[model samples]
Target: MLLSLFTVLLWGQQKETQEQLERRKQQILIEIKSVQQLLQNERTKERNILAEIEEQNRKINLSRQLIKNVQQQITITNASIKKNQKEADELQAELYKLKEDYAATILKTYKSRSNQSRIMFILSSDNFLQAYKRIQYLKQYADFRKEQGQEVKAKSEELSKALVRLEEQRESQKKLLAEQQQNEKNLQKDLDQQKGLMAIVQKDQKKYNDQIKKKQDETKAIDRKIQQLIREAIEEANRKAREAAAKAGKETTKSVGSGKNATFELTPEGKIVANSFKANMGKLPWPVEKGYISLPYGDQPHPVQTHLTIHNSGVEITTEGGSKARSVFQGEVLQVQVMPGGNKAVLIQHGDYITVYQNLSEVYVKKGDAVALKQSIGTIAANSTGKTVLKFLLSHNTDINNPQLWLSRSN
Candidate 1:
């Protein structure tokens, strides 16, 4: 009864541990889901959620797998215990027989225990060879009995250990199974949150598209402006390079970077602006925090009317309810224009690179003011029907580039 009560107590403790592990797993799942929601957030503040979600998912899977292993172990352990019990019972019967046989031998020896009786028993062997054989047999029988006793003792020890091992396995199964259950619940919750976000996005698609289109127009305007500047800059660079080649032909072999002539054209302020942008390439941040790139640089389908195609000078990152447009790199603000339907756009110029932030509801920087990387140019506007978005662009003179290639991926 004491042993039964102890086993029950052990199981209860195991169950409690399992419950605690389950709760912990659930907590991680909840965290992962929360991160997923952040990725869907329109404001997209620090979208570090994706990595968190992925990492949590890996752990959840591992936990589930471990639970499965524990369950299998429980089954195997139970089977082994039953087999051990049966073998132990057989060993006990054999042990009893060995004891009885040993007792009978001793009893007979004692009953006939006289020196004359022993000699007569030996003489009954009838030949010297038979007597020698009887002595050898007696020694062998004693050794066999000792070995049987050792076998029974070893079997009992093995059975005891096996039972303990089975209990441990059973406890593990309970604990891990509880953890898996908790993880599953957490996963369900996350799924529900994501579903809610997706529904919201779908419901606001029309408003989002209108906002995106207005921003796209603003981006195009900036592209044209940047292109004109690039052409002038390129022409100036070319003319200076020619002059430098004529004046410093012998020294052309002295420099390895871009032609020195291209360096002399920019005024002090312009040089500073250009240099600042050049130093931060591959380091610029994204314009908005949340959203997957739906339409990248080059040609793309109209988000509102898929059958009607349009060329995109930049990428469109579609995100949830609210987001702001920010500078991707440091530069002088060239212009901020308010478009029809309440959206605004900002353009910033670096030496050779130009960045544009569109779909804003308001402007923060005026033309000629320096804007730093990730500085909010303005809150993005809600398009017709009221949904928020940011359209972002990167370009060199007239050439449009995929923003995915320019902005630091770490952002």
Candidate 2:
């Protein structure tokens, strides 16, 4: 009985693990589909080789992940199959033993089946007390036979169920194996396409390198401007606070320094907002509703040019064309920056923390406008390549942070 309980618990855990894996695999597949659709849309427009390569790379990565997930599922199914097979064998053996013992009991009863034999056996007792004891013993023996028969029936049913489970597991393993094969085939195709694109890129490495360098320079300029704006915003907020304190006839609060060392001197209300934003770290909504991170934060090697490193102050999320950028949290709009390329950005202040939504074609909320969570702030501009990408940045005072860390995982 203990062994059976342990087996049940083990099966339950494995089943749960399998279910989790299946859900993850399905999610990956959905993401792959989304990426493919984006890639198709890009193809309909003028080709941007770099953007195409990035999209392809994303699809390849998802494919590899799907393959890995399926492999894990196959591993689990194999283990389950093996376990069930062992259990079924054990049940068969137990059933065989039960049948053997029950047959022996039946044979013994058959030899004493005559009513006279049973009556005589009880009558032949040396005294009335002995006869009564004999009758009780016969009754107990009959009860034992009935219980043995019942146990045999139960064992037979258990064995049948085990066999059925074993067969089902085998079928599931077969299906998983087929699915894994298809995923491998698709992955191979993706690799082949990637190789073709890489070959084309290798021929004109210098041109692509120059493009990457130009883009990097633009990014650096943007980052510098963003930092400057954040510092200015900080100084402005602090200046207002100082004036308010002076009017109230209180001693002027000490300045919080300048540049990278700048910090917000929060008021009582500002402190609450700052604290709330900080407390909700990693639980904030995504800046966009239906998008995926095309580029992550920090310095990483370029996807096409591995020799070149790219620095990102924040993440870039690629979404459907014409998708509106939304606020991740409730905050007051601090600035509306119009870049050199005519693209606009909305900077929102949640106390000392600021979130920037860049690459906007239009802005809905102006400077000082109060925005609620998930409020549509602006429309993300689609580039000539037909790709709509949002450059999202997060900062505490003037210090930059990885926005991906603050955004929820579902994004």
lDDT of each: 0.59, 0.89
Q: Which stretches of candidate 2 lie over 4 Å from their true place?
A: 1-5, 126-133, 241-256
Candidate No. with top lDDT: 2
Question: Model 1: what TM-score?
Answer: 0.40
lDDT of 2 by residue, 1-411 (tens): 998899899999999999999888877887898899998887887778888899999899899999999999999999998898888898999999999999999999999999999999999999999999999999999999999999999999999998998888888989999999999999999899889888888999889888888888888998888888888888887887778877976544355778778988777678789999999999999999888888899999897788888999999988888999999999999899898578998899998899999999999999889999999999999854568999999998888999988998775
- C-alpha positional error of residue 222 in candidate 1 after TM-score superposition, expressed in Å: 9.6
Per-residue lDDT for 177 in model 2?
93
Clashes by residue pair, model 2:
none
> lDDT tens string, model 1, 1-411?
997587567656655665654565455444344435534442444432222233334334444544554455445445545654665566667667766776776676687678787577667897999998877876686687677667667766765775676566567657656755775676566556545544554676776556556756865665565455444444554355457667855222221234222222344455576677667667677787655454567775553444546777676654456566777766776656655455666767776556777677778788768877677778777543233556777765445667777777434
Instruction: State which candidate has the highest TM-score.
Output: 2
Give the true-structure RMSD of model 2. 2.7
Candidates in order, TM-scores: namely: 0.40, 0.90
